[model samples]
Target chain A: MSNAIDRGKIEALKSMLLSLHKGESIEELKRKFKDVLETISPVEIPLVEQELVREGVSISEILRLCDLHVELIRDTLRSSLLMDVPKGHPVSLISRENEHIAKLAEALNVYAGALSKASSGEAESHLKAISNILAELRKSRLHYRKIQMLIFPYLERRGITAIPRVLWGREDQVIVKLRELSTLVEKELTHPKEYPNIAEKAMEVSREISDLIFREERILLPAVWILLSEGEWVAIHEAAKDIGYLIPIDVEWASRAKLLLPYEVNGVVTREQVESLPQEFKFAALATLAPDTYEVRSEEDLEFETGFLSKDEVEAIFRHLPIEVTYADVNDRVTFFSQSIFRKGFARTKTIIGRRLGYCHPPRLEHFVKSNVDDLKAGKS
Target chain B: MSNAIDRGKIEALKSMLLSLHKGESIEELKRKFKDVLETISPVEIPLVEQELVREGVSISEILRLCDLHVELIRDTLRSSLLMDVPKGHPVSLISRENEHIAKLAEALNVYAGALSKASSGEAESHLKAISNILAELRKSRLHYRKIQMLIFPYLERRGITAIPRVLWGREDQVIVKLRELSTLVEKELTHPKEYPNIAEKAMEVSREISDLIFREERILLPAVWILLSEGEWVAIHEAAKDIGYLIPIDVEWASRAKLLLPYEVNGVVTREQVESLPQEFKFAALATLAPDTYEVRSEEDLEFETGFLSKDEVEAIFRHLPIEVTYADVNDRVTFFSQSIFRKGFARTKTIIGRRLGYCHPPRLEHFVKSNVDDLKAGKS
Candidate 1:
C-alpha cells in the first residue's frame, strides 16, 4: 500500500515539475505547491529535497518546498496521529513528545468548549493546565537549538542542508511565541478575570508547536532518509545520545534499535554474510602469489616438474649431481629440500614449505643464497 | 680479393644447386663434379654439409661433395702458386709446402732423378731430415688430437658444433696418412733397393698434407669466422698456447697475426670488451638496469610499474628518483642506482649505486632487510 502511494506521488511530482516554466511567478509556484501537497504523500517531502540537491538545485528552493510540506502534514495530523507512531516503536520518544503536545491541544479545545458553554470555573482549570504544558514545552527550546546549530551543519556537509534549516527556523519561531504566551499566562493566572485571554494565547502556542512537530516528522525525518547513508545515520544516532531525548526508553529495545540501524546501507553483502566469513579469509583473497616458483628436482633423474616438485625428487637429484639447485618461491617459501645420499641424512619438505627460505639455512648462509638467487634471476650473475 | 671470389662462387653455387635433380646417380654426380667444384668455394663445404643435414640429404652425397671440395682446393692452390716463391709473403707457408711437394713430384718425373734422389749420398741426408720432420709433425698431430677430442666438444656444447668437427676430421685423416708414409720410409731406409716405392709413397703423403693446409686456410679458417664469436675465438687462441701450434712460427709474426684477427665479428665484442666494462656492466644493458631498479622499490612498486607504467617511463622515473636504486639487472648485475643528495655525511650514491643492495648493508642486517621487504610487499604484515 505504501509502495503504491509512493509510485503515485512520483508520477504526480514528475508531471508537476515538467509543467514548471523558466520564469515561474510566485503565484504559479504557490499553485504548484498546493497541487504537490494535494497529490504527494508527506513522507516523500525529504526525498524530493534530496533529489533537488542531487540535481544541483538551490538550497533555498528546497527550504520553501519544506514550508509547504509542513502545512500538509499539520492538516493531515489534525484529525489523527501520524501513521508512523506505534506502541514501544524505536522512534517512540518522538511519538511521546507529540502525544504531550496533542494532550495540550485537547486541553485548550476543552477550555474553549467550556467557555462557549458558559462554565467559567472549568475553563479556569483548563487554562491553568495549558499554562503548565507551555512551561514544560519552553524547556525543550534549548534542545531544539542544539539540533539547529550543531547537528544541521553536519547534515549540511552531507548535502541535507535545506530541510533542517527550514524546519529548525519554524521550531525557533514556535518557541519564541510559546515563551511570550507563557509570560502572558503568568500575568493572567495571577488575575483570574483574564483566564479566557490566557487560554486563547496558550492555544495559539500549542498549535504552532503542533505544526513544528508535523514538519519534523514529514520533512526532517524523510530528508535524513534521503541524505544519509546507513553508516552516517548510525553516527548521527550515536551523537544524538548525549543530548537527551524528550521521552525515555527501555535499554534493551534501544540497544536492539541501534543494531538494526543499517550500519552499511550501501554495502554489497548483507550483515549475515559479513558475520559468517572467517576473519582470517576476509582479506586473504586479495594477496598475490610469491614472485618465483619453488622448483625441486632429483639429481638422479633430470625428469622433474617445474613447479611444486616433491622433496624426494629434490633429494635424489642433488645427491648425484655435480651442481646444486636451491629455490625459493615468489613468496620466498622454502618448499623444497635436497639431501645428499652420501651424507646419509634426510631433508623434509613439510618442515620448510610454509617457512621462509632464510630460516631454512644458517643465518650466515641465508644472505648469500638470497643475494645469489636475486642476482641470478635478475640476470646479474 | 677473397670477398669478391666468395661472392662470385656463391652465385655460381646457387645455380648449380638449383639445377641438381633429386636421387641423381653417382656416375651422373661425378659427371657434374667438375662444375660443382668450380662453383663451390672451399670455405662453403662445411656449410653445405650442414645444409644437407638440415635438408635430410644423404651422408654419402655430403661425403662425395667433401671429396670434390678437397680436390678443388688442391687444384686451385697448385695453379695459383705455380710461379710464385715470394719469401716471407703472407701465403709463403703454403707456397713453400707446395714447392717441396712439387720438387718431389718433379724428381719422380724421370728415372734418374728418382734413383739418384734415393741412392746418392745426398739421398740419405735428405731421408734423415724428412724422418726428423715427420717425427716432429707426428708430435704435433698428438697435440692437435688433444684439442679436437677434448676442447671441440666444449665448443660444440656452446653452440659451435659444425666447423670444429669438419676441421678436426680433415686433420685426423692427414695424420693417419703421414703415419703410414713414415712407416714406409722406415722400411725403405732398411732396404735401399725399395727406395723408389718408399719415396713415391712419401711424395703422395706430403702432397695430401700440403693440400690439407690449403683446405684449412681457405675453408677451416672462414668456417671458424662464421661459427665462433670473437670471445670464443680469443679463448681458443688462449687455450692453443698451452697446446702449441703444429707449424714452426716466427713468434713476432704469429703474434702480429693474432692481433690482426677481427675481434668484433657479428657485433659480438671481444674478450677485451667484457674485461673493459666495469665488472658490474659486463653483460647486456638489461642486465645492468634490472637489479638496480629491483633493489630500490619493493615488489609492490615492481607490480605497479610493470602493470601500469610504460616501460620507458618506468626506467626514466626510477633513474630520476633521488635515492640511489640498484637492481640485480636481468643479468643479475648490481647494475642500477640513483644519485643520492647527502654525499659527505650520509650514504653516497657513488658508493652504493652499482653495489649490491644486500652487500651495502652490514652482514647482520642484510637478511632482515630482504625478509622485511619481501614480507611487507607480500602483505604478510
Candidate 2:
C-alpha cells in the first residue's frame, strides 16, 4: 500500500460514499464499493479505512458533502435499536444496553454532586446517597458487561466486532474511575478532617464519567456506522425488547444499511439459514420463495401490517412515555399516576388512590375544590 | 388642665373617636381644638374636628369596649393623609401620572402576580409591530387624556413635571404592555391571538388591558421568566433606563398640606384664616414661627444609606441603569447582549456591554469558539 495508491483509493471511496443516497438497495452499495475497490491496490485498504475513521470532520461538512439521505442515516443509526429493530436482533440489544449504561452514568453524576456537597460529619448520609447512586450506576455496568461478554461474541463471529470492543474499553475506564471515587468518599465519611478534599476528588471522578458518556456518544456508537447490518440491527432490537433503557422513549436510528450476497452463496444456503433471517427478510422471502406456499392479495393495499405488542410490553411502553401521566376517576378520586423521579412534589398511590378529591385541597380551601369540580360538571356556575 | 381633668379629657376624646388608639398627643389635640368648636358632643367633636377636617374615621359598633392609643390613631390618620393627600409628593407623583393608564390597574396588582411579563418586541420588526399594536387599539385617546387632564395636574404641581405627559403616556403603556407580551410570542410581528391579544389590539382602548396582560402572561411569561431574568433581562433593563418613565423619578411636593391635609376641611378653622396665613407661616409656624429660620443638619451627619431592591423593582431599576452591563464576560464573548433602541448593536459609551462574551464569534465556528472559550477559561469554559 503506497501512499499514492492509498490516497487515490481514499478519494474514490469518499466520492462513492458521497454519491450514495437514502433507500439505495443492497446491490447499489455493493456496486459502488466494488467500483472503488477495483481501481485501488489491496494494500491501501487498511490505510483508507483508518483515514475515514479519523475525527474533525464537521457535522456541517457531512451535511454538505454526503450523498446519503440525512433522514435515512438518522433513522437507521440514531434511532434506539431496542425500540425500532425487530426481536432477536443484535443491534437492538446493544442499544438497550447502551441506554442502560447512560442512565447509570447520569445517576452516578447526581450522587457524586450530592456527596461532594455533603459534610464530613454526615458520613452515614453521604454513604447512603452514594450507595443509591452507585447502585444505579452498577446496574448500568452489569448491562454493559452482558453485551460485552454475551452479545459481542456473536457479532465478532460475523466480523461486525471492532466498535463494540472500543465502547467496552471506554465503559471499563468509567467503572474503574467510579470505583476509585466511591472508595475515597467512603474513607472521607470516617474522617471528618478530609471533607472538602474528598469532595474535589469525587467531582473529578464525576467529570471522568461524563467524559465517558461523551466518548460513547461521539466515538463509540458512531463507529458502528462501518459495522452492524440492517438485518442484524433488526434482530438485536427484537431480542432486547424485554430489556429496559434507563430513560425510555421511542428511539430513532441514525442510518440504514443494506446487505448483499453473491448468487453462488444463495445457492449454498440451508433451511436453518433461512429461518435465522430477520422477520422482515423472512416475510419478504416467504412472499416470493414459493408461490404455492403463500397466499396473494389482489385488492389494492393501503394499510401496512406489523408486529403486535404483548400485554406487558404495552404497559412498559406507556410507563416509558416522555410526558408524565396522572389520571383521576370520573368521581374525581385519584386512580393512577406515573412515578417519575423528576416529579416536583411527593405523590403516593397509597395515600391518594381512594382519597376524595377534596382531601387534596388545603384544609382552608376545601370549599373551593368542591365548587370548582361542581362548576366543571354543571352547565352553569 | 388638672391631671384628673386631663385624664378625663383624654378618655372623653377616645370615646368621641370611637375608642381608637389614643396616642400621647390626643389630649393636646383635643385641648387645642376644644375652645374653637361650636359643639362639645363627643361624637360631634370627632366628626367635625378629626374626621371631617383631617382623615375621616367612622366608629364601628364592634369597637365599643376597646382601649385606644391617641398617638397611634393620630399616626394612622397622618399616614393615610400622607398616602392620599400627596398629589405632588414623590410617591404620589410617580404613581398618579403613570403613563400606561391601561396597565396601571394591573401594575398595582404586581403583588398578586400580575404585570411581571413586560417585554419589548423585536429589534426593527417589533418596533413596527408594537407601533401597529398601539395604533390598532386606538387606546391612546382615553389613556392619554386621562393622564394629561386628570392625573398630570396633580403630578405637575409636585416638581416632578418633566416627562412629556402625552408622549410618555403613549410610550410607557406601549413599553410595559409590549414587555408583558414580548416573551409569549412565537413570531416578532404576530402575537398569539388569544387573551391579552397583543397582536390583535395593538392599541385598542379597553379597560380590560390588565386582564388581557394577565391572561397573556399565563402562557408567555413563565417561559420567558426562565432565561429572561437570568441572561436577557440585562438588555431589557438597559433599554428601559434610556426610555425613562412617563413621570419624573424625583418629585418635590407643592406644599406639605397636600401630603398632610384631607380632601374635606372641617369648619373648625375658618377658610379666611387659612388663606391669610403666609406660606412660610403655615409650615414653619406649626412648630416655630420666624421667617427664613430653619433647623439644619451638619454635612457629617448626611451619610449615604443603602437599601435592598425588591425582585421586580430590581428588574425595573436595572432596565433604567445608565451604563450597559453584561455578566460572565471574561468567560464567554457575549452570551447575552443588550441592544438599546438608540444604539445599533454597539453601546455608545460602554461598548461590549451586557453581551455574553461568547456571542462575539463569527457565524461559521460557534461550536469551536465555545469549546476554546470553555477550555481556556478553565471551569467557566
DockQ of each: 0.01, 0.01
Best by lDDT: 1
Positional deviation of residue B234's Cα in model 1 after best superposition, in angstroms: 86
- In model 2, state the lDDT of residue B352: 23
lDDT of each: 0.43, 0.36
* lDDT, model 2, position B46: 21
User: Candidate 2: which stretches are off by over 4 Å?
Assistant: A1-107, A110-118, A121-124, A154-164, A183-197, A222-226, A234-381, B1-381
Q: Candidate 1 chain A — worst ten consecutive residues by lDDT sum?
A: A288-297
Q: How many residue pairs clash (N, CA or C atoms closer than 3 angstroms) in each of the candidate models, in the order given? A: 21, 67
Cα deviation at B246, candidate 1, in Å, is 99
lDDT of 1 at A353: 26
